[model samples]
Target: MKIFNTPSNSSTFTGFILLGFPCPREGQILLFVLFTVVYLLTLTGNGSIICAVHWDQRLHIPMYILLANFSFLEIWYVTSTVPNMLANFLSDTKVISFSGCFLQFYFFFSLGSTECFSLAVMAFDRYLAICRPLHYPTIMTRRLCTNLVINCWVLGFSWFLIPVVIISQMSFCGPRIIDHFLCDPAPLLTLTCKKAPVIELIFSVLCPLPVFMLFLFIVGSYALVLRAVLTVPSAAGRRKAFSTCGSHLTVVSLFYGSVIVMYGSPPSKNEAGKQKIVTLFYSVVTPLLNPVIYSLRNKDMKKSLKKLWGT
Candidate 1:
């Protein structure tokens, strides 16, 4: 595949031009500044969580440990695309190597899958803590938490391997310009040299299934948790349970709701603007909010944050 030059003259393509959000030079500069601020905040917020969890001795429990790991994942998840997007805003060509695009596609989606699994595991932890309080310690040991974290990362990354490899192997027609910010599967498919019904079918199946299933698992876990919380005789216990669960539920709603709206049907070619907004919400905004949700909602986390900042 030819690596450079005019798409009109070349018969082969080895790179793609990402026409990210058509705008004037001034508009791109404005966007660059805005995204730069948001990206920095995301890193600070999530990085603070990991630091708080580590520096604070009280947070050595299974819940904080998992939260720390999830924060770590969020860091990479946003990094997989935001930096590149920010760079594209400043660059003239906005060119991405074929290998670079697929790598972004893989890491971005994998981290997202890992996040879904992490959320589900966190729900399970809460369920065990609430519904089976007597067995909670024995069941959700630190060892088990570590294993669950490992499994989430492993499974999340491995989920997209076959489809990405299969799709990357397919030939691409000329005029390799993707009409979005990142290398999303749908846009990539549109650039393929021929109709790929089988590949599309595989995407249709594999794309939303895990997200749907994991979301259902989270909801089911929360259902039992709610039942158990209601049965608690103490109102204080109930309030605490609701407060903790509420934060997780909010993050879940923000992340999954946008994801479901965006990739619910493999993203049609017409919704590019709306898709960018939703993707921006889940990918950039959600990570920034997660640390705020946890730290403010949980008393111990607030105390830890205060201590971390010496305020």
Candidate 2:
């Protein structure tokens, strides 16, 4: 690989060549088809949840409202990368414009951040509903729910603005090839002309703080919920409480497990392939599974979905 100088101005650089899963032509085609099916399923699954929430009056409470918003977020979240990935699979030259790359980077991370906050908010809602049931209605009002939703979006987008801007402003060196399907920060940072320890330190600190703190809060919330559920005495009541939380817990595990593996620590130079596989699991697989998990496990969601479909 020949090393060349990247223009000082980011705009002037030709573009990035994403070396995404180099394989035989047949393999590429197979991947394209497989990913296409996954994308369509993800859209349908999440879309159904959104529509179900919208049409069903019974699901108008804060839990369902947050779920609807989460499904909406999943749609955009998967969209931020999968389409471009599909396109890359077909094309011989896997070129992504500088602006386009950064745009993908921005939205991918922003939506991911939003998801983290949304999960925390959802956990908090569950906490109030389960642990403090008497005051749940008064505390988690429509206004408060809407405000929490707004805050998730606002904080998610704002969280990475400075870091992404700073990274983008930095100069890129030769090679101009990203090793992954999407515009990930690790690969992007690897392409930089010079490494800035200060920026790396800042990103390392910022990237994991929200996730770790929110995860701890969720654990605490669930612990209290568990204590409350234990006090209910009746087996049926305990089962119902666990059923309500089961879906959220599953989704949270899938999300946090993959994310912690990928971003909790710095990306290892030799683990690019492992990182890509883990990223694919969360980015592509989890979204498709969420609706299925929620609908199948929760009677309320199943009924709502059935009513929405008129089945």
Candidate 1 accuracy as lDDT: 0.88
The alpha-carbon lDDT assigned to residue 140 of candidate 2 equals 100
Candidate 1 lDDT at 15 equals: 84
lDDT of 1 by residue, 255-289 (tens): 99998898765546678788788988999899989
User: What are the Cα lDDT values of the candidates?
Assistant: 0.88, 0.90
Q: Which stretches of candidate 2 lie over 4 Å from their true place?
A: 1-12, 264-269
lDDT top scorer: 2
TM-score of each model, paired residue for residue: 0.94, 0.94
- Model 1 Cα displacement at 106 (Å)? 0.5
Decoy 2 TM-score against native: 0.94
lDDT of 2 by residue, 1-311 (tens): 42233665655577799888989999999999999999999999999999988988889999999999999999999999999999999999899987788889889989998999999999999999999999999999999999999999999999888777777787797778998999988788888889887878878778878888888988898999999999998999999999999999999999999988877666576687977899899998999999999999999899988887789
**Ten residues in sequence with the least summed lDDT for candidate 2:** 1-10
